[model samples]
Structures are given as structure tokens and as C-alpha cells.
Target: MSHDENNAVLFGSGDEAPSNHSHNPHFNELVDARRRQILAGGAALGVLGFLGVGLPGESQAGERHLPPFGRRNRLPFTAVAVGRADGISVPAGYRATPFIPWGTPITGGYPAFLEDASNSAQDQAEQIGMHHDGMHFFPIDAQYGAGLNSRHGLLVLNHEYIDAPLLHPNGPTVVDGKRVSAEQVRKEINAHGVSVVEIRRDVRGEWQVQPSARNRRITAATPMQMSGPARGHALLRTRYSPEGTASRGTQNNCASGFTPWGTYVTCEENWAGYFASRDSDLPRELKRYGLRSSSRFGWDTLSGDEFERFDATRKGADARADYRNEPNHFGWIVEIDPFDPDSVPVKRSALGRFAHEGLVFAKPRAGKPVVCYSGDDAQNEYIYKYVSRGKYRPGRSDGRLLDDGVLYAARFNADGSGDWLALDLQDAAFQQACAAAGVSFADQGEVLINTRLAADIAGATKMDRPEWGAVHPDSNEVYFTLTNNSARTTADAANPRVKNAYGHIIRWREERRDNSGVRFAWDLFLLAGPESDSRGPNGQALGADNMLASPDGLWFDEDGRLWIQTDMSGSQLASGPFGNNQMLVADPHTGDMKRFLVGPLGAEITGITATPDFRTLFINVQHPGEGSTANNLLSTWPDGPGKRPRSATVIITREDRKRLL
Candidate 1:
């Protein structure tokens, strides 16, 4: 899912639709030390405790107290078994209702959906786009109190990308080396972006979308500003913005993040291949990000202002006259003020861009700098953290706060310890290392533009496709999913499995239990595989009960329950007992995991968020019936027979209306 669009994972990267990972050396020693620690009854050796954390009733920074995370968020539901159902499977007493599907109108300007799939590009702009992904709900101030109506909130979610085969009337029609239909191209263009619509629960507790002026769509053509060190760099100048201050569109938005001040962060993952660069002397960063000779969608093959923009090659005299720098504007964390749909999305450049899996904040202190943790969603990629230079006041604006921050790449040492190396080009060690690698770092912007290269220069640990990250709501401890890497030829102590196919979870504690720290301790939380391979001392797998693979979408509910979602490929779904990708509940405190819901065929269960009351939960089903064509459909879920399989969001709740465990 991280490398290519057609092969695997979910609709794109990051497991869930709107969703959103590494290790390092000290190699054999780290492994030997961990093994010794485990044998000495230190299997619980991960950096877990928070020495600086203050308990409830004590003077504290915020309303919540993270009382040693994992042990607190336990669930009481029974774990479901694997199944090969053609439709999604949920536990008894829990009902899953189809909430919103692709093409649903969110604004007054949008037209009703057409089952024949003949919606216009203009129509999609006003309607809900395809492939719903990571999302968050921001309750308005008036309805913010508990026991109040929890439905009147802005529902913000990512439309990852379209399912091409089903999107077009008869698939994409190609003619004369180009798409024969201009309207189809327009439809596809409008289909990719973020959707913010207002939803409300009625007196009967039924959630429904209502038309409002606030309903808006931020698409691939919308204008966006660049915010950090890379904002006005020479490499970012393009025909659209000669000063390199801004760019258009926010594509490949996978996972999402919500700020304490009420802004939504939409991350761009796997955005490189969407552009085409034909220059012979393209920058190393451009080629490394996978800007190719032609885009997979081939939108560049068509002619017109809208279509030609997809071609990022240098066709004019210089960067100012061409679109060569267009791709550079992407691969960032785009922050949108969901409450203000008319507001412009800002590309927070301080967060060094890679295949941005998602963005989640480290727990904040009353007057301390805000911290962010993210993973580069690719095989053997590195994880990153951004510590803002400015302190975030509880009521101060959260937007633009990410503009000035120190981006750090992680380096794991052998003895369960790690360091966050600064990706600063001015650092003497960085300068020497860059010189040795035959790379030149002229300024801080260059380091951010060439983040992957900078990380290499910094000796960061490579991970097995790090995906979504979930920070404990109370503790701020981080948990990242190292989604499997089948390309590994040799196994390392940190990445235990050779030809690692099943993936695992890695958790780390910040130094002194503070979010803003340069050092930390780490450990492997779970080695995901078949049930047999995950067995324990008594020959039984899991002290609780769960067998899964490629852990992708993850989130920590208010009550501290860690939700684990699977992202088995369409081909990999049948390879083991881990049937079609599903959602599982995990107890970080006890390391107990249980299966919750299993999705339909050819789909990945992703994008989950809950209402404040926890009585309503939302999860997205991406690319269901993926390989099926119009004539030979694979599934009929959420809809009756004879309809195209759609990427949709499912609302799950207890039959008794109890809070989600």
C-alpha cells in the first residue's frame, strides 16, 4: 500500500481510509539484552512508567491524568473468531449501521446520488467524495457538555482516493493515448480530497447529515499555503506561485489528527506517484519521492489546464514558469480548521515530510511546547517527531503553531534506549555526515525537502513500514504499527522476523515521561502473526486472545482503550486465519487483545473515531470488492444485490446504548 497504488494494503496507504511507523541498530546487543531482560522476568521491560506525571486531584497541566496508560484501558467484550464472510461481521449485541457512503450529498449545492454512477465532477465537488478514511469529530461549544446532545458536531474525514473501476460509468475510457472523456477526468479530480460535513443525532439518537454553509470540500485543486522552513525555498517555486509560498491540493490524505484547540490535521501519504516529472536532471528528492515519467492515473495524458497540472515536469524556462515544483508542495501535514470550512488548509512544513502516515500530538503541558509524532509509511522507513518552539496556551489558537519546530529523526540504541537526532543541517556532525555522503545541505529547508536523505545522514533506524500511531490519551506514551516488510533479506534483533510478513507493534516511553524529550526507552509490544506463531509459555497464544496481521489503523479512546485494526491485502486475506481485515480491541495495561469486527471481502477495516459519550463509534470500510469489475461484481454489502461495492463508513454501537468499552 505504501509503495504502489494497485498492489495492496487499503485503498492506498495507512490501512484505514483516513488514517494514517522503525528500528535501528546496536543490533545483536539490543536483542541479546532484551532476551536476557525477558528471561529475567523483565518481558515487561518497555519504557512504561511516567516519573513526572501528576495524578488526579494534584496540581496538573490539563483536565485528564494519564495514570500509567496500558493497564487502565481494558475492554470486557469477548473476542470474536476469524471468518470468511462476504459481508462485515460484528459481535452480537453490537449493531453496525451504514452511516455515510460515497457520493452522499453534504451541501445544498450538491445533487442527489445517481446509482448509475453518472455524477458530474462539479457534482462530486459538492457531494461526498469516494474512499472515506481517517476522521475526527469536533463538538461545537454549545453542545460540548456531557449528557448534552452529542450529535451536533463537524464530521471531518479524508477521502483517500477513488475506486477507478466503479467510479466511471464503464471504467475509464481511453482513446488516442488519453482519456476519451473530459468529464470523467474532472470527476476523478474532484473525488480526491477532504470532506467536512455537519452531522447530528436526533431525539431518537439517530445520526443524520444536514445541509449547512459549513459543509465544504478541500480538493486537489484548492489553494494551500506552505508553513515552515521549506515555505519560500527555491526548490518550491512553481508557475502557480513564483515566491514558493503556496501550492494547490492536498492529495493522498490517509490518517487524521485533531488539535486541542479544535483544528483537524490531514496527512498526505503515498502522494509521490500522482505526479510525473520528465526532466533529465531532476532533484534527488523528486526522484526518491517517486515522481515518475507518467502518473498511474494518467491524468497528465489528457490536455487542459486542470489535466496538465498533474504533469510535474519542467516544460518551461525555469521553476517559475513550470510545474516541476508542484510535487514538492505535497507530502505534508495539511491542517484545516474544520469549524471554519472556508479557511485555507496550511501545509505545516516544520513537520519534515515523508510518506506521512498520520499526525497525533504528544500530551501537552500547561505552558510547554506542543509535540507531534508521525511515521513514514513505507518499507524500512523512519519515524519522526516535531517539537514546537512556542508554548501552546490552552485557549490560544492552535493553527500555525506548527510553523516553527525542531524536526527529529529517531535512532534506537541496542540497550532498550533511543535518541531523537536533530535533522538540522547546521549541526557540525550533520555537516560532516552530509559531506561524507556526497550530499550538500545548504540550509534548513534543504534538510526538510530531503528529509529521507537527512535521516540517512542522521543514522536513523529503518522500520518495517511504520503506519498509524496512537498516543495514550492520558499518558502520551506512543504506540506505532510496524506493518510487515516482506523485503527484509536478513532479520535484525529489533525486527525479529526474517522475511517479516505478519508485522508487529512497537511502543516507547518518552524520557522522564515527558513528551518533549531527546531520549527514551523502547520495546516490542507484539509480534503479529498466525495464532500458532504468537503462542506463549503455556503453548497458548496470547494471555488474552487475538490473532492478526499487519496492524494498521490505531486509536486510543477517551477511556484509554487501544483499538487495533488490520490491513491484510486482498491476496493475503486467504493466506491465514486472519480473514478479511478486521478491528480488535486491545488493553495496553495487560497487553490483552480481542477481535471486534471483521469486514467484507476485498476490504480493509479502517478510520475509526467515537462520539464524546462513546455510545457511537465510526469505522470506515475501504476499497471493498477491490478487484471486481462492473460486469462481474464481488460484493453487495451495505446495499442489496446488483449494486457496485462502495467505500463507506459504518456506525457501530451497543444494542443497549452503553458506552464503547
Candidate 2:
């Protein structure tokens, strides 16, 4: 989710600004070596197909290797035209039913949704959270080879953030300069985390909320434990958990990942804006993260420990005496076991925190180290990968494997090759770089605590706001969305457009097909924008059927079809030919792309997943009337005329009940 139009202005653009003092070369200056290599490969290589040229006398063997990735069954549905309709739009034969809107109740006596937004804090805790972002559907009968079961499962999703005006009946209440209603504040807090709801398809083919103990809500006020290398670090110490073993909750969870062992990973993005500090000289940890004297929300202005914790001022003599270290508790990837409602969510800090847009694990192999990828989601930030020290075992549901790992930052070079700089004290290169930068780490824990600083010392490539990542199911290649960076003034091969507003997607093949390898080959998969400005992987402008901007949510289904969703900002959506934020499908092999669905007015199309059988598809429509104020409403989505707009997930399926693709 892009927060630039929201409260992001409160925090200056220093974090989002370009890095003028970095030691690394301009990230986009790719050399001609890759072009030469592609030309030498003739028509056999996938690179040639991506380049959209065919060589004369192409061998039969070339045809076998032509697809950039493994072949997936071509998308069977007709393309949906771009539109600004105030409701869901899908292909002709598909039915998109709005399910589980913002206030839907699934647990705790099942409180019915009240249209006037009078739900209490406790009621909000038991219902679905607002602004759904990333999600996954866990099948109920996976043990019996029914992983593809379309009938029953748990739907787990992250509620990125809430719009205060749309959340309350008449917006938030203010007395003088402080928030006067603690209940409203509590409700807002309750709506800012992850939700695990049990859903099942009935005989009539409609998915319904199932009443079960597994249905749970992990809110911002929920109790959680801290784990990994930085678990007991002094930086994590606070009044809430003096030993640094626990944290309160997760916030700004933008995207997610699911473990092979049936667990969910929710990433904390833009979480720094929630904290405030009065200290004139803030620590680098807080300052680099954009923490100001005033937070995005005035939760600190209210009384009580829960609300006061938002203020990270150094009022007390020690960290334990105040909530100064509270902000550190967030910004880590939180692991949750949705099937076990009694389990406590753990903040896995070993992944190395920044604005973690999402975490996408590579294909896990038994007896091999677990590897995963994440993007920082801030201008000039870098992409990261974590290689677990412990070998991954099939069906091991523990997240502790993520605790002991070497977190690496990517450095994309000009020759289409990249190195993963280890952010470890044990690495000689890291030590030398740290010495040159006049920075030293007290211990490995400190290095993990200050991950962004460690990456800087190691000289990682500055990216154009890397976001959601997806690993190709067959090729094992990794792709990440470089969602626009308006502050960027210089263009390079990796990021070719100055003030890149449309954004682009980049993918790479790891060295020797090993996810833990330190080196890789990369290229721009697609540049997202209007047909006039954007270019597809084939070096041609995007056609009418597939024009897009701000590529955000991304996924590859079991069949290897790449599902791309957009998150165009208000300014871009209004000015560009792209009618609204949309979801598109693309063939990784042939580069054939088409628009799948277009969202309602002022909404972002994100959080997509499907039944194992590919018979049902689920996507989220977030913040329909995004810029709506207390007195003005721009759209009423999922509900008609005069109704309050609510963020909800839409379940799409073929009208004939056939497989989606």
C-alpha cells in the first residue's frame, strides 16, 4: 500500500530520497555484456524470447528452451476492459462476489455488522480487520493429499492500515489538540493487524464464514513474543517487556508469505510512522526510519500505557522506565500459526528489518538451508535475502529456523550480474566496509538490530522501492516489484526512467539454481505504465489489454501463471490512461498479458490467492473511497448508494463452476 497520499508527509522524504553519498555506482548503468550474451544464444535462450526477436534457422532444441520460465496453461478467460466502475469487474463468464467486508463478524458471539459504524473495540477485535493487503488460503485436508481442496480452509490476511474517517461513524473526535475518545482509539488499534478466519464453500458453491476455534484476530494490542538473533538485544528492551523477549503487536502489515509447514508470515511495512519522539537528537535506528515528534496517528495523545506507548520520547533515565524502545518491537516479519489460535505470534528479527513489503520463500528442499526474499519498500532501499543456518525439514512448523541465518542485501551490477552482500560480522568484506564507514557492531544482534545501516556499510544497490516478491514455481527464478520512486532523478539500466512513476518488475535467476547463492543474473521483466511510456519485457510498448502502473501485489499460481496487481496513487490514476488499479495475468513463456480485473473507484487491487485446484480466486479491494474525508465520500463499493465504503475481499469463480484457468 502506498502511503504517500496518507500520513506519510508527516515524516520528511529523507528516507525516500535518493542516496547521493553512496559508494556504489548508479544502479541502472548495465553494461553491454548481457546484450552480447543474449545475442550469442540465438533463439534458444529465454532471454531471446524476452527480447522479442527470432533468429533464422532456430533449432528444435531452441524451442524447448524458448520459454523464459516453465510453461503454464494459457489464461482461459477473456480480458476485462479497464474501467472506473464503483464495483468489482471481471471477465464475462466469471462471478465476483464480495465476501467478508470490513465489519464482518466471524468469531466471539458473531456480532453482526452495523452499517452506522457503531462497532465497539471488543467487537472490532472479533471481526475482520480493515484494508486487507496480502493473504493466503490454507486448505483443511492437506494431510490426505487434499491440499487442493476448494471446499474448506482458513483464510489468513493482513489489514495494512485503517482510514480513521471511514472507520468511525463521524470520524475521530478531538478535544483541543488531543484525542478525546479512548474507545475509538482502541477500535482503530484493533483494526490494524492480521485476521485468521475459517471459511468453507457450501453445497450451493458459495463460500461462507465457518464458526470454529481456529478463527482468530491478531490485533495491534495482542501479546506477542520476540524471537531470532535480536530477541534479547538491549535495543528491544522496553517497559512492556524489560527482558526484550516479547513485544505487543504487529502494525502496517502490507504483504505476506506462507511457510511449507502451514504458518503465515506477515511483514511490517511503514510501521515507523506510528511512533513519535520528543528527543532532539534521535538515534539512527529511529531517525532513519522516519520517526518524528508527532506520529501518523495521535495515539500518544491519549492516556493509558497502550496509547502512551506510541510516544517513544526519552522521558525516563533508562529504556525500561519508559516506552522509548517500543518502536523497535515492530518492523520485523511476524510469524503466525493460524491453525492454532492459542499460539503467540513471533516477530522474526533475523530477517533484517526495513520497510519489509513482503517475504517470499524459495522452493524449500529437505536437508537444505531455508532461503527467502524480502523488499524494503522505500525509495533508494535495497532487496534482501535470508539463508537459514539450520537445514529445512519437511513439515517442520517451527519459525525458529528463521532465527539463525545470514541476511544478505542485493547489489545489482551493471553487467546484469548481482552479489548478495552478507550483513554478517564474520564476513571479511563486511568488516572492511564497516571499518571504512567508521561503524562497528557490538555483536551479531546489534548488526541485525541496525540492518539498514549494515546494508549501507556493505554497499548494497539503491533500488526504486522494491515491494512484493514471487518465486517462479518451475524456474525457481525470483521477481520483485520496483514500485515507483518519484524522488529518483537519475536513470540506469535497472531503473531506466527518471522520476519513475509507473514502476517496473525485476527478476533474477540465482547462481547454479541455488537460492542461497551469493551471486545471480538479473533483468527488467517489465516496465509498468501507459502504452506511450511503458515497455514490456519484449522491448515493446504495453498494449491496451495490459497497460498498468505501480505494480504492487504479485503471485504465481500452481500452473506458473503470473498474476500482477496494481496500486496506482490518486494522482497517477486520475491523470493516466489506466482507468483504475487492476489485476493482470501474464504468460512467463510467451509474454502474453491481459487485464484480469479492474477495481472500483479509489481502490487498490491487492492480496490474491486461489484454491489449490484453481477453481476459485480471491482478491482484495482496499480503501474504495481512499481520499474520502468525514464529510465527503467518493465511492460506495460492495454496497450501493449512500452507504459507507468498506474494504473487502472479492471471491471470483467461473459461473459454470469450471477451473479458473
- lDDT by residue for model 1 over 1-661, one digit each (tens)? 2222332321233232111121234232345545544323324322232222232222332122445544443567777778777787787788888877888988756698887788888888888888888998777552234424467787889988777668877667655444557788888878988998888888987888877888898888889889889989998998888999988888888888887677889999878777777877778778667665756666777787677777888788888887788788888999998877678889988898788989988877768888889998877678999888888897664766788878888887666677788888656777787787787877888789888878877788777788999998776778898888786766555555567788877777776444777777666667677755552212235432578888999999886668988888855796666788888886665555688998988887889888888889999998787776677688766686899888888989889998867
Q: lDDT at 74 for candidate 2?
A: 84
Alpha-carbon runs more than 4 Å astray in model 1:
1-73, 142-149, 535-545
Please give the lDDT score for candidate 2.
0.82
RMSD (CA, Å), each prediction: 5.2, 4.6
Q: What is the lDDT of residue 37 in candidate 2?
A: 45
Cα lDDT tens digits, model 2, 577-620, are: 88889999977777678899999999999998899888899999
* Residue-level error in angstroms, candidate 2, position 431: 1.2
- Using TM-score, give the best candidate's number: 2
CA displacement after TM-score superposition, residue 283 of candidate 2 (Å)? 0.9
Q: Which ten residues in a row have the lowest lDDT in candidate 1?
A: 14-23
Models 1 onward score TM values of: 0.90, 0.93
